[model samples]
Target: MSRTIISSNVRSYFASLWTATLYHAIRQSNWIAIAVTGVFSLILFIAAEVSPTEGTWGISKASWLSVCGGVFASFLFLCIQSMLSALKATNRDMYKAAFNELVEKHGIKTVFSQRGSDDVITLYRKLLSSPRRRIWAIGMTNKHFVDQHLESLVHVLTSYQIDLVIAFWDPSTTLIVRQNGGRARSIIEAQSALEGNPGSKWGETIRQRQLRIANAVKDQPIRGDVRIVNVSSVTSFSCFIIDDDLFFFPFLANTDSTNDPTIYCAAEGSVGRSIIDHFTKLLQNSEVCTTTYHQKETTVVVPMT
Candidate 1:
């Protein structure tokens, strides 16, 4: 084998040996094997002092014993440090292996608690750098996504032709909105004490959410067409698909979707595929959203029938 291969093999062997030694040291009780060597060295010191021999093999007995004991202690100290360093390195490798395993099993890439954070934005910008053919976003209103990502989308639109679809829960008609103790308008007293405020914002239904989409993309993109799929109740999570990456997260009842943990998955993978399939079926059964906007086109409003 070449020198490089031989070096690699040797390194691997030492790494394994060091790791094994560390584990063995951890498993051993206080009566460790190294302590026996220390005891033997102590006995040698006593022998050196007790013996009357001035020298052996032209070396003073006491000095020889002292040198031997010093060498033994130095070697032991080096072994301990090497093993500790090895243990530290192996732990890091174990963490990487575990992370890879999770990614393989669930198609889960990055998982962070806050959505639309700097990390999410950075990831999107990087993804936009690649050649993208299609982009689909799914969520409850998806207002947060549009607010943070529309700038990058505009920039990419100038560069390449991409098919963009924004799928959101119909704010006015979705039953998935917080029922807030399951109290329906008909059941609750119109002027009861329970009605502390006359407003509900689990979703902002004040203006058609499609208006936000329309306005965000109204500035005609020379390349991309933005479409909307307004579904009612299949809104399990907020999802954004840009090419092969699917970004998604849950909707916390009391807080914004941004407060939930967002998950990244490969668009071709199982988790992403299942989500896409559900939306596809919903789109097939879709009605034209209340407010429709495609880049550079006149905004069209469809009355709920």
Candidate 2:
């Protein structure tokens, strides 16, 4: 450990030991304090009884002196005990302040053990069910999210004029979506130690989903004009904002987001707002493409031979 840390720890340890052992060693008793004070008081009483002193109202001088000395010693002990109690309270407040600062620094409210777990999905459903004016996403194709939460999304988006935006990685420039500074692996290099799947193999084009959303918007009471856009920058995380809730997922090597941890925070928090700002910039800088379905897609089936 660093010198400062070790010194602080050592200081804290002694302070605690002093508070506990000298004052509160026994839960229901103060034997040590009583004994130490008793001995000191006895010495004071003895010294005062031997001192030469005057008497008041016919009281013996030695008797009055000893009495005053004993009372003074008792009061001193009481003050010391009170000081220790106050010290403990101060320490507790300091610790609480430190914890609050840590929480503020990260702006994290909850850390879901696993992303896409039952509780996480349930929370998403609940958040979507609420009345909202818009929804935003930053992720890959977002097919997985749509396919998985289609019902909830449709229900919520249709409940009100909650617009949706899906800003996904542009597949053309996403040939290598590794972490920043990650060395590029050859396409021929098979994914082995890691399920190092190439970017192209994932996130299907949003062309079709856009049409579905368009159709819903045309007929549904709610505005479901899902704007699908492409982002050229590489990302190591996916963020989704539902109402005031922000869900952040940092990708792990070869692991699907569903298996990774999820950080949930309020949109107003420092972490959440910063991420939303970045996503807003991504959409603004990239030309957002809005697709309108001219007509229902038709298919001609060949006669079976």
Candidate achieving the largest TM-score = 2
**RMSD in order of candidates:** 11.0, 8.8
lDDT of 2 by residue, 103-204 (tens): 566567789978779998888777777756768877756666777766676676656666577666554442344563666542222221144544444323
Clashes of each: 0, 0
Q: Give the TM-score of candidate 2.
A: 0.61
Question: Candidate 1 residues 154-273, lDDT tens each?
Answer: 666667788777776654452222545654542111211133433455344424566655655555445656676555553456677888898888755433445667888986767878
Clashing pairs in 2: none
Minimum summed lDDT over a 10-residue window in model 2 is located at 296-305
TM-score of each: 0.60, 0.61
Which candidate number has the best lDDT?
A: 1
